[model samples]
Target: MSKEDPKTNSGYERTLTNAHIQLIALGGTIGTGLFLGVGNSIHQAGPSVILIYIIVGIFLYFLMRALGELVLSDLHKHTYIEFIEKYLGKNIGFITGYLYWISWISLGMAEMTALGIYFQYWFPHLPTWVPGLITIVILLFINLLSARLFGNLEFSFAIIKIVTIIAFVFLIAYLLVTGGKTSFGPVGFGNLAKNGGFFATGANGFLGGFQMVIFSFVGVELIGLTAAEAQNPKVTIRKAINELPLRIILFYVMAILAILLVIPWNKIATTSSPFVQALGATGIRNAGSIINFVVISAAVSSTNSFLYSAGRLIFSVTYDGKGKWNETFGHLHRQLPQNGLILSACLMGLAPLVIILIGNQAFNFISSTSTSMFLIIWCLMILTHLSYRKQTPANKLTDFQMPQYPWLDYLTLAFFGLMIILLLSLPANRMAMISAILIFIILWAVSKIWHQERAI
Candidate 1:
C-alpha cells in the first residue's frame, strides 16, 4: 500500500484520490437523511423546509472551510482529533474523540435501520432484521478488504444517488413544461404554494422541521477524515471542500425542490420517501419499484461511509496513544485497522437488529440522537479552529485559509449554539438533546478519572 502524506508514520496507507474523497464526502451527506428523512421534514415544515436546508448548508460550508484551513496547517495530522489534542487539551481531545465515534456509530445504526425499511418494500412479509443482518456482514467483509475498496464502493454509491437526483430533476422539468398530470396532481412550481401557502405548517412547523433537516447534513464534514488517506492531502481536500456548495445545491436543494414541484407538500406521505412519492405520482409504470431500488442503494451507501468513518476514528485515537487500548486497538493488519474495523462493525451492527425489534419508534430515536451528537462535534471543530487561528504567528502563512476568519467563525458558532437550544423546543428532539448533554458529562468524567489513573 502507498502512503499519501509522509509527515507522520502510521500503519495505514494512503491509496485514495480526489475522486474518492469527493464521492465519499458526498455519499456520507446525501444518503439516508435525504432519501428517508426528507419525507418527515416535508411533513412537518411544508415547503419552508427548503429554507431550513439553505440555512444549514451555509453554516456547514463555514464549518468545512474552517476544517479545511486547520487540516492544511498541518498535513502531519491524519485526524482532526490530533489537532484538537494539540489546541484544546488532552481531556477535550479524549472527549471529542469518543463523542465523534459515538456520533458515527449512531449514524451507521440509523442507516442500517433504514436499509431494513427499504428492503421491506420488496419483501413486505420478510423480517427487517434479516436484511439488516445480511447487510452488516457484507459491509464488514468489504471494509476489511482494503481502504481503496471502501472508497470504490462509496464512489459507486454516490454516483447512483447523484444520477437518481439528476434524473428526477430533468423528469420533473419535462413534466412541468409539458403540463403533465399525475395521479397526485399537475406538475409545476404552483404545487409549492397551492397546498396552504409555502409556510403551510406555520412558524412552529418550520422551526420543528430543523431537527430532521439538521440530520441530513450530519456527515458532510467527514471530508476531514480523508486527509490522512488522500493522495495529496492539501490539494485533494481543498478541491473536495470547494466543490461542496454545488453538491449541496444540486443533490439536496434542487432534488427537494423538484419533488415538491411534482407533488404538493400536504399530499406527501410521511412514511415513504418524498422522491418515491413524487416519482410514483407521475403515473409512470413501475416507477415505485425503480425509486425503491434507488433508495436501497442510498441506504447501503450511507452504511458503507458510516462503517469506514467509525473505524478510522477509533484507530486514529488509539494509534496516537490517547486511549488505554493503544497497542491492541491500534494494531493494523495489512495496513488496515482490522481490530478497530471489526469492533466498530460488531457494535454498530447490533443497533439495526435492536431497532427492528423495537419497531418504528427506534428510527426517530436514533436519528435524533445522532443529530444532536453531530451538532456538538461540529461546534467542537469550530472552537478548535478558532484556537488554532488565535495561536498562529502574525507572519505565518497557511496554504488554505478559512475566508473571513474571525467573524465568520464566531457567527457559525453562534448559529450552532442556537440550533442546540432550538432542538430542545421540539418534543421529538428534546430527549436526544438531553441525552447528548448527559453523554458529554459522562465522557468528561471518565476522561478525567482515566487521566488521573494514568498519571499515578
Candidate 2:
C-alpha cells in the first residue's frame, strides 16, 4: 500500500472513463439476481413473471432519475448518502451510510456464493464454496491495483454479458419463428399461453415472486455509486441514467421473454440458471456450456462491482469522522481506499463459510437480505431527493431533474413500500426482512452512542 493520506478523506480520482461508467451501469444490473434468481421467479409466477420484472424495473428507473438529479445537483459529493446527510440530516446519514455499506458487503457475499453454483454446471462434483473463495482473492488483488483496472475489468465483463444476452434473444427469436423443437418440445408462443394460461400459478404466486423479482433489479442504481470515480460525471451519469429504459427492455424483458418462449416457464429450473436450461434443451452442441460460462462471468463481474461499491462506501462514511473506527477505515493509500478494500473483501471472503453453513439456501437468503436493506436505503434516497427539491428552488435545480417532481418520488416510494410489505408477509422472505429491520435499529442505536461520545 502507498503512504496513507489522512489530510483528505478519500484518494479516489476521476480515472473511470465514460465507457467504463456506461458498461458498469449495464453490468451492474445484469448480475446474479437476473442470471440465477430469475429461475425462482419463473418457478413462482410462470410467464406472468414478465410483468413483475417490468413493474419493478419501472419503479427503480424512477429511483435512478431521482438519484441522478441529486448527484447532478452537487458533483463534489462522494456517494448517495452525502445527499441523505444534506437533506435528511446527519444522524440519518450516519445510519444510512453504514447500512448501505453493509448492504453492498452482503451483496458481494451473495454474488460470490453464486459463483459456486454457476461453476457446478462445468464441474458438478466441485465443492460449492471453492470457486467463490478463489475468486474473492484474485479480484481483491486486481481491485487493489487501481480504480482504472477495476473499471477495465467491469467493462470487459459487462461486454461479455451484454453480447451473450443479445445473441440469446436473437437466436431464440429465430427459433420461435421457425417452430423449432427442443427437448422440452416445440418452441412457440403457445408454450406461454397454454401452461396454465400465462398466469400459471395465479395471483398468490405472482405476488410471492415479487421479492425475488425485486432482488433481480438490485444493482440498477450502481451508476450513482460510480459518480465519485467517474470522469465527466455530468455527461456520463446523465447518459447512463437516461438509457435505463432500453437496458431494461433488452437485458431483463427481452432476455426472459426469449427464455420462456423456448422452455415452458413451469419447466424452468430453480436450482440452476434458466438461461442455461433453455439453451441446453436445444441440444445445440456447447450452447448450454457457453451460457454457463457467461453466467459465471456475470457472477464474477457482479462480485467485483459489489466489492468496489462496499470499499468506497466505507471510505465515504468514515472519512473525516472522529473515533478509532473512522481512523481505521476512512483513509486512503496509493489514492485508493486500500484498507477499505481489504476489509470489505475479507468480510466477503467469509461468504464461503456461510455457504457451508446454509448449504443450498445461502445465496437466496443473502440476496433477499440485501434486497431488504436496499429497499430501506432506496426509500431514504428518494426522501433525500424530495427534500432536495423542496429546499432548492426551480431556478436552482439541475437540468437533469426528475420530471414531475414530488409526485414521481411518492409513486416510486409507494411501489417500494408495497414490495417491502410483500417481503415481510411472505413466509420465505420474512426472516431476512426481520433481520434487516433489526440491523437498522441496531445501527440507529450505535449512531446514537457515537453522538453521545462526541458530545463529551
Candidate 2 regions exceeding 4 Å error are 1-10
Q: Candidate 1, residues 308-371: lDDT per residue as tens digits?
A: 8889888877874745588877767888888888988888778756675778777778999999
Q: Looking at candidate 2, what is the lDDT of residue 1?
A: 14
lDDT per model vs. reference: 0.85, 0.89
Report residue 411 deviation for candidate 1 (angstroms).
0.6
TM-score of each: 0.96, 0.97
Task: Give the alpha carbon lDDT tens digit for every residue of 359-430 in model 2.
Answer: 999998999999999999999998999999889987998899998878999999988888889899999999
Stretches > 4 Å off in candidate 1: 1-8, 322-324
lDDT of 1: 0.85
- What's model 1's TM-score? 0.96
